[model samples]
Target: MLFVEAKWLYNDALTFMNDHDINDYDSKTLTVHVLDKDRQPVTHELRYLSSQMRQSVIQGIKNNMKSLATLRKHDRKTGSLKYKSEYLSINLQQSGVTYKFYDKRHIRIQGFKKGIRIEGTNQFWNIPSLEFANAKLLNLPDGYYIAITTYQTKRSEERKYKPSIGIDMGIKTTITVSDGRKVKVLVEESERLKKCQRLIARRKKGSNNRYKAGKLLRRAYQKLGSKKRDAANKIVHELLEHERLYMQDENISGWHKGLFGRTVQHSVLGLVKAKLMKNERVTVLPKSAPTTKYCPHCGKLKKDITLFDRVYECTCGYREDRDIHAARNMILLSGLSTCGTQEINAFGEDVRHWQNSAVQPR
Candidate 1:
């Protein structure tokens, strides 16, 4: 699949007439909806919005551009960036869209009939998704440009095994699998974000420089988020290839409230939680189940265990790495609970154990 952006089509329409007394750019607002490959809406409110909303929408694009630029600067190796700097690609909130890339010519943005020609002489790195979606519109704030990019999708190889696994997510590490495996994906704190944040913090509240710093910091955060999302996707794909999986009702939010607060605040656990919940083969254990506190074999509760203790050593001679033990317990617990019910919510139906919260549950 190609990475294509829908831009400029509405820019001319948004321009104001010089003779008109009214601000045409502000008055003539339009909203655009995203259509799927089959032209169905994927989002509810993200469809075409007013020009003000569109300007705000461009902030998201600006965020993406800033992030790409930061990644290009810091993630470069051997004098080359990990992600190419030649093309700045983004997905506008518009719905119903699909695209294709060809070797000889320009990128064809779906929905619109004509293809936007490719920009520059940059080479295409062979990636799978290029067949359906190639980078078409290299976008900048001033005007539309052509972009060349790579696309990658899962390979066509057939699966030979039927094993599946469930996970317990945590802040210090990425995930704790039920099979005694701990996948610790590390994220280095963004130095650029820190610098921007510090600069913004030191400036006067409403100054232009302060505003610029805020934008830069926000971009740093956006880049950090993208990196995390890519990592989560790769890990989730690996977990899903298995035949079955058992996952826990984890306390990701509680972790965010405690010490190491900022470090784990915007953790990948949220993305992992989302990915596992959507998978058909994954069976979820109730969030209240004490995967960390309860023993898998003897059903004993180790109330004294602390977060600093990396290993789970119980009085019953049960010894395992803390995350691994929790992961295995997740698989075991998945079989005993209702689809979304956790032990905390296992009380009478009238009690309503689930609190009103915005948690991204697993």
Candidate 2:
């Protein structure tokens, strides 16, 4: 009900923005036009969404306007914000005022009198001196989730790290590590997902059966997303244990338009790369670096190398798996290349990095 009312307010506010200033549309009683169960237009009143939530929705419109204007200033092609059929997230504008934590497993929302029991509080419940900030109540297809913004002092332990390693991203195997580890990446859609998709195509459009089928499809996609995220997290955790990681900035998305488009769709390589790059320990070699063509042992470029070659056989008597050879060479190449430092976080709120390099003549 909260999400439905919020969506109504958002669409109503967007409609109002089309004619008048959004700042002028902060009325307590929001009247909007919505389709009825019989597929006829009907007038509806938004009474569930709180004043703060409504303001957040309006402020969202103002923010969109600002973003569009900024894009136009940069001469980028832009489009006006359109009315949405659904609003997936509602900003809890302030911490204590809009929402409050009653206990570890329960929270109270401003519009609701009774406390809502939430299960995932165990994630950050034990942290001492944690201060809650603004948060978003997300209406995911599978369930409702509140993503809270919290602040805590950084961990003071100057940690130990493992020896540095280099990585190679490739088509045959997803990740090849300098330490002789190859991790394949692929997550296929579940049988239930395929069934749900087929069921939707057969259901009549605009009917209740179709609506139910669409909901199931969304749930399946959400489940698929959870699996991909889990797989990416596990892979990232294992790789980031090293002190200084090196990898070329290969264009994974470009590979999507080529022969392995379907394979790329089933793989979590893109997510793994994004998470790895966020860590300061990860060093991204430039895109132009010839990880495969350059040989570390011979100190020469193997210009005759082709995609069909599985083994890197150098004139200097270095014979190795092609992927492993490329992975090892990443460590060598990064030392010769110049790179700037930047700071970046998991959420990409701040973005930058620094990498260790050793000077060696090629």
What are the lDDT figures for the candidates, one per model? 0.55, 0.79
- Give residue 7's lDDT in candidate 2 (0 to 100): 75
lDDT of 1 by residue, 250-352 (tens): 6777877867677675567777777778866677666666667766545667789887888888776768778777776565454434222123322322112
TM-scores for every predicted model: 0.53, 0.85
Candidate 1 lDDT for residue 178: 61
* Winning candidate number (TM-score): 2
* Candidate 2 residue pairs in clash (backbone atoms < 3 Å): 342-352, 342-353, 343-351, 343-352, 344-351, 344-352
Q: In terms of TM-score, how similar is model 1 to the real structure?
A: 0.53
Root-mean-square deviation of every model: 15.0, 7.7
Full-model lDDT, candidate 2: 0.79
Cα-lDDT of candidate 1: 0.55
